[model samples]
Target: MEPAQLTAAVVSIVNTLRIILEYMQNRPKRRQHEDDFDEDVDTDVPESTGCGNWEIVVAVGLVDTVERQFWARQTSTDWWDRIVLQVWDDAQWLQNFRMLRPLSWNTVSYFPLPKMRADLTVEKRVAIALWKLATPDCYRSVRNQFGVGKSTVGAAVIQVASAIIGVLLLRVVTLGNVQVIVDGFAAMGFLNCGGVIDGTHIPILAPDHLPNQYVNHKGYFSMVLQALVDHKGRFTNINVGWLGKVHDTCIFRNSGPFEQLQEGTYFPDQKITIVDVDMPIVILGDPAYPWLLWLMKPYTGSLDSSKEQFNYRLSKCRMVVECAFGCLKAHWRCLLTRSDLSTTNIPIVISACCVLRNICESKGKMFMAGWEVEANRWHLILSTQTPG
Candidate 1:
């Protein structure tokens, strides 16, 4: 072998060794990067191959891009903390929540909501429920407005509604101030009238159980709200959750008011004589209800002049309940639309709306004129579509 040939081979071998050493030195950095992303990526990549390490790096980059996109899609501004908390105007508070802040505080004082989270205060829970009731917004929309999760908004609504039913239902809807109600009715030319009774249908989605039973003659799924309202447009008694297919008379017969009247314990023993017949303080009803001693119904077919006049007077006074129903659905727009809540929750929500309506009326909260216009428009459309 010549010296020149031996030197060339030796230099070539040294260059190869240096290249291998550099590759080994850079391997630890790549391994460290892989270890950082091992918990996030589920793929198993062999350490022996450069191709496998490249695949893991690509996967980690893709995951980071997806996370950034997801966070970008969320609203940047917190509505409750940034917008609602900054507003100090009472008008704005009422516009958003449908009641003044003071009344809302008073309501929260009656009952405490279940503590679901540290941020979900009693005031915020009540606001969430009231906003849901006053509008047709879905849970996601409400969640965005209140800066809460979608499930949290839904749970808040249920909790607040149950609270209202428990604490306010009996207190608001009862036969209190009986003489005042009777006097209000007498001014409308219906003497000895304690109140006017009527029934309205609250629209609902078809349930899985007994769907046919909830279908009314008007050809829609609903639940009946049999309510007795005073002349001042306040609900005195309400029987809710009956099937829409049930008749008003049937609901009346099974109601608490019915049992009270039958036991002769409803009124204060006040009687009035008309045509030599003594009648107790009676509630006026439409022809759909039965004529009881303590309940009066308008005359039916084949009416003479005297009977016609009697029916006109009775119906004139009965208009109060119709107006009350209109106001109830108008103020709480949730009752105007087909509710998406479960059947079990719908009754509680409806009863809560009734109680809230009575509270608003009793407290003299201003009802917007625009609400009535929209309500009448919706009612007309519903009437035409479901003629009975």
Candidate 2:
């Protein structure tokens, strides 16, 4: 057969490149004014054009248009539908979005009309903040993804998170829900358990003002997210913003929850009799917490027959806090690493994580992944507890 006749059998790299060049030359250059989104998309073809020159220009234009459309869609007023729906599954996103409208107002509620910008919708603002908490990406990355300014992203994060914490704290963590919490522990065979308290260190970048103060005994810069998790992997009370250098017990002692317990305001006037001794409901804590009438801590090092049994039961119930931390951190992987947020704003971010965690739980969001890995940060108390 003639070479030209047999040419249908194959095409070499040079031929393919030639064909691509021919295709680009014929393929109409995307009209610069094809759409309103492409008003100023100037694709500069660098000097020294090769056979692939037109292809690069067309490819650049294509990327530019697609990216503009993507950012437009993401930054649209209907961000709940475009961005939030895409990030969180439809079921979970809609389930927890009831408060988005109400809480979103907090962002601009305090500002005067002159200061408020209508270009960014409340839904978009909240979505940006939620994205910051729900992923490990930096806020600047999130800003670029959504076509919003980085500073706007940071401000929206704190405002939206603070609003969420204020709105959800009472609804999710109040003592009014103590009975349900008690029932949760009872089912686990920990009698009269009120709450599970544990403190997890939230790693952070060194602070500008006081880097030394933020460094913990283990020699890492961090803040502590001291939580009072109830049974069923929910945080009932959270005391965040404490420096990692401080001990968990000391942080607990200064918390509002502890003040309530100490002042006899933690629980209503009621008593549950255990072992013939009438006592108010109490939290189940690890050794890092002081053992008090309102708290139960596991026995240290040596354990006798019954004391060993008591410690075992306590460990099982107290494990809920660890599980709770696992679930919380797993849902929001941002907490697993050192965040770029400044020391003053880190607590707001942590509080926001807790708030969203409860919202997911409150709306029956699924957590099939279940618990996160155990970090094994325990301050085991060496002092023995005398039997009641």
Candidate 3:
């Protein structure tokens, strides 16, 4: 073969191969995932690197301005409406519930990515956490609605819930200053009643790690939220870490109130004298709880006229706790829906809801409609006067 013919054939083969490679590289790929666009790019930005082109500089600047505008448009009213927090613009409820009494959005605004539209403030993140509890929207919905990542939505909920559980749980659900609850129960016609206990189920998805642990006798995945509510629908005590399969009796037995009652330290020296009997102060419970001196349960099976009347009165008062649970579930509709949180985090979420619910109860629901601007300086009411 001649030298010219050999060179031409080699050149033709190389050109054909290059064309096929280019076509393969440019072909459209199947959309496999929700966040495929977020594929990890080699965005290893050089520390001292500047924009190599004027177009890149203008694009980055334009994106940054748009992001700032979107974030600036975050309204507290949107939070209230979405979270069902029943608050208004700069409402006291938002301040009290999120535990950001003094911190405003200016103090908590996060510097967002260049092209990302909106970023959440600290207060908004807490509000989003509460909104996740109040609405049935999933993480994807939150991501789309807030212009954040799905993982960011989950992280926000967890972070805010942790804060609430740390700062507000002990303050609201405590034995130290619950004399108000005891007095309220006395007025409700239940003698010597300090609190009313009840159990509710929060629906959740069957856990992937241990599916059997989440299945209840009702044949669904859930967890128990055993709470002791006051006459005004405030949660004075709560225990919510147990699995759905666990019975109410088992949960009550392991609760802090039950442990206190067993040690005879719950409201010691506060016995009520009736019929020449020195009956210890007691918290009302349904038949699900074991009858004890400090824990009164309605009589099971049969009852005389006097016993029936007593049971009726106790049940009527105990319904206060049920109403409290109803109110909590009604406001936080997420509790009614199947939760996306893991089994370990489910308790944390419920605890956060309880804290928020107590905050609302403290600021009476009657004040929801006529939110007075001056009322924004609301403080926790503490009292030392015990029931005589």
Q: Per-residue lDDT of 231-319 in model 2, one digit per residue for the tens? A: 87777788999987899989988988888889878766567887899888788888877879879999888779989988888899988
Sorted by TM-score (best first), the order is 1, 2, 3
* TM-score of each model, paired residue for residue: 0.79, 0.67, 0.67
Write model 1 residue lDDT over 237-330, tens digit each, in one string. 8988998899999998999878888887888888889889998899999888888898888888898998888888898998888989988888
Best-fitting candidate, scored by lDDT: 1
Single out the weakest 10-residue window by summed lDDT for candidate 1: 64-73
In model 2, what are the clashing residue pairs, if there are any? none
lDDT for model 2, on a 0 to 1 scale? 0.68
In model 3, the runs with Cα more than 4 Å from the true position are 1-119, 176-178, 366-388
> Which residue pairs does candidate 1 place in steric collision?
none
Off by over 4 Å in 1: 1-77, 380-388
**Every candidate's CA RMSD:** 11.3, 12.4, 12.9
lDDT of 3 at 304: 95
- Candidate 3 C-alpha lDDT tens digits along 306-333: 8998898898898888778766765565
lDDT of each: 0.79, 0.68, 0.65
